[model samples]
Target: MSYDPSGNAFDFHGSSYVALTPNLRKLGGEVEWDNATKSATVTLNGKTATVRMAEESVTVDGVQQPLSGPSLVKDDVLYVPASFFRDVFGQSI
Candidate 1:
């Protein structure tokens, strides 16, 4: 949130969490899961992002960074924090 000089405040809202596969598909990216590691590999434009469940971080092209929130798997589907799609895909999901 932010406020202008006139004391008018601005607020923005978006999903803090996002389901992986469908969201990635929107960006023309491919996602693959690994049951053993409880992680998913996201491929987009030759770049790979590894999203691990239960962790608050993602490894993109070998570089790991903290996520906006922790990730988790629900009903066998991987749900990631919105930050990954926003920051990595360079667009809103």
Candidate 2:
């Protein structure tokens, strides 16, 4: 599904999916993509989540959890599900 980012929520790709950089960074979360692993490491506060773009699950601090959908990268922006914030970072989303 496509995302929409607006205010505290989300809007789709022009404004962008979860709008990664702007919103996530504001939340004190950082994401780093690894081309070799095809996965991203997301750190928020002291929590760490590993999202593989081709997989529908995330590993948080060594714990594996299912995600609403797989993460994605398009036009160089990372698009993770809103549920990611809730499940991984303990944010309400």
Candidate 3:
């Protein structure tokens, strides 16, 4: 799923998924954002994963997880794969 700056949604990655709104909580188990570090933390099943905004990839328990699609940062907001939520948050779409 891909959402442009204009809020237009598309399945550019062929996942056929689209988020109606940017609801971090609904997409994951627990979501935390650190404004100072510009990073987001997602905890699932007692496992915590941290994603740095400026970084090209994210780390799960210190192991790098390659992203399948391009991450879009627009207006200071980062849009990543909803699968990331499922992987780290143990939630299903």
Candidate 4:
């Protein structure tokens, strides 16, 4: 099946881990996943946020931390909490 951004877009059917992709580049969002740390870094407008896999939470600029829900991974891509873009980056999906 083709990946649909509108349906099951938020990877809610598996582990809490989610992957981000370049398709979201239009939102001016950048995601960096560190294999060693198993942490995902999200950057927007020069501001950066780090989310630790073990914690299943995100910290923005060392403050304003938020807990994330379930995440999905398919085809080596990570699908994270959809609200991440809006709540963290201030971007309207």
Compute each candidate's TM-score over C-alphas.
0.77, 0.73, 0.59, 0.66
Off by over 4 Å in 4: 1-19
lDDT (C-alpha, whole model) for all candidates? 0.72, 0.68, 0.59, 0.62
lDDT, candidate 2, 1-93, per-residue tens: 343334333443333236445566878788787989877787897988887875778898999999776666665566676767877777754
Per residue, candidate 4 scores C-alpha lDDT tens digits across 1-93 of: 236554345434442322455635766677778989767787887778886654546788888566566334565565667676666777755
Candidate 2 whole-model C-alpha lDDT, 0 to 1: 0.68
- Per-residue lDDT tens digits for candidate 3, residues 7-35, read 43446557433332354545545667788
Off by over 4 Å in 3: 1-24
What global local distance difference test value does model 4 have? 0.62
User: What ranking emerges by TM-score with the best candidate at the front?
Assistant: 1, 2, 4, 3
Instruction: Please report how far candidate 4 places residue 40 from its true position, in Å.
Output: 2.0
On TM-score, who's better, 3 or 4? 4
Please give the distance, in angstroms, between residue 9's alpha carbon in candidate 2 and its true position after superposition.
8.7
- Candidate 1 deviant stretches above 4 angstroms: 1-15
User: In model 4, how many backbone clashes occur?
Assistant: 2
The better candidate by lDDT, 3 or 4, is 4
lDDT of 1 at 5: 31
What is the lDDT, from 0 to 100, of the residue 64 in candidate 2? 95
